[model samples]
Target: MVLKIALIGAGLIGREHAKLISSNPRVQLEAVADISEAGKVLADEYGTRYFFDVREMLDATKPDGVIIALPNAFHAEAAMACIERGIPSLVEKPVADTLEAAMQLTEAVERKGVPVLVGHQRRHSPDIAKARQLMNEGALGRLVAVNAMWLTDKPTNYFDAAWRRQPGGGPLLINLIHDIDCLRFICGEIESVMAFSSNEVRSFEVEDTASISVKFTNGALGTLLMSDTAVSPYNWDTAAGQALYFPHQPENTYVFAGTKASLALPLMDFWRHENENSHWQHPLLRQHITLDGSRAYENQLHHFLDVIEGKAEPIVSVRDGMLTLATILAITKAGKEGRIINVADMLG
Candidate 1:
């Protein structure tokens, strides 16, 4: 049976969701809600209803599930509407624009016991899921240190939106938040962060580059470098060949070093000595980790279907998304203040 799904927003990602929902046999695009005519056009294309307000769409269409792809600030409001109607929803990443907003929505969902999945779609990628499985199985064996990168170049007009020139719209939240979420997913909770940021290239008040130091609650440490004004394909979106829009560039963007061995992601190369208990002086051997050969977005939609059916739980819940947002916020605060910021303190 095809489940009817509605979408909020008609922007880039909202369009992507429309296409994805249309393509899935298990789901149908029931309606679209946006304040723009684009929403009407998209609904016409998909043979679905259109509404200027998400609440009106929800009340009229009463979809089995909703996908909120609106701007960050509207995420909570849209998802709350879904929860109010006792409908499950997939709220696109960051969960909300502010930590408080996220908590508010999270509290409502928890109280009502209405399932709302936070869209950190990368977590659904085969490689990311495999990494977490490997870590859990002690394949990495006591995570020690890690390194990651997300350097890329965006066209000048990409920042034409005024918000992109401001702090919240920069790569830290716009791009690097994925990396931060992946790190937290693969490694563990981020305890604190210290960073150095600059806006020299774009100089639009938002940082164009940053270097981050991370300390995990589990005692693992990691480093990350990010930029949207640089020319490089060392980011997971490209390197993993899993992202929807980017051309595939096979490379390793993250490396996890542990007491027993080391692992490089997207490449899935596991490195360790010929002997398990060998010292660093010994030569290292390489092995590849096998994956299920699935795509991220598709898997995410399938999982959302499962969540709506009460057959699965959300992998990235709202509270969990808050932690990721808080961690990134900590990095932002750290860079701005020139001091270490604790992730937990950000919630208080």
Candidate 2:
């Protein structure tokens, strides 16, 4: 049986979700809800009903599941609506604009026993899954250090949106959040964070670049560099070829160093001493781990379908998304205060 899916919001990401849903033979785009004309245009294009109000669409269409891709500010409200109606939902990440709202949404989902997934789609990537497996299997030995980068140059026109230049719309929230989530997914919980951010390049209200230091609960150390004004290919999107808009670059953006070996992400290069000794005196060998190129979004959509059918639990639950958000928010707070922020305390 085809699951009927309703989509909230018609922005770029929302449209992408709609396209994916429509392309899936197991799901049907039953309706769409958005405050703008784009919603109706998208609905008409996809041969689905459209409504300006979420309540009206939920009441009328009675979709089997919902996909919420509204702005960060609206995520909680829309997600709560779906939860209240017992409709399974897949919400785009950061979950909500604030930690408080995300907590409330997760609480409501628990109370209602509704299934909800967060769009940390990277977890669905075959490369990431394999990396996690290898880490768990001690292929990377005792993970000691990690380094990641998300440097890119955005076009001037990309900042034309008023929100894009606002405090919450910079590279930290807009881009770095994904990296934070991936780190947490592959490594473990973040214990604390310290960061320094700057808007010197654009001098906008939002930060254009940031350097972050992280302490993982498992006693691992990590550093991350993020910028929206750099013309480099050291980011997941560019390196992984996940998004078609960016030209794919053959380079790894993350490096994981462990006691036994080190690994470079996306490129899937594993480095270790030719002998098990793993000492400075030994020759290091590089082995490239092959990956089956899979589309994360498509895999995510299929997982959501499994969730709606009660066949599987969410890969990224609401609470997990909140934790990721707390980590990023702590990074932002650390940058602002010029001190380390405890992620656990911030979550509480």
Per-residue lDDT tens digits of candidate 2, residues 103-162?
999899888899999998889998788888889999888999999999999999998868
lDDT of each: 0.91, 0.91
TM-score of each: 0.98, 0.98
The superposed Cα distance between candidate 1 and the true structure at residue 86, in angstroms, equals 1.1
Point out where model 2 deviates above 4 Å.
none
Report how far off residue 211 is in candidate 2 (Å): 0.2
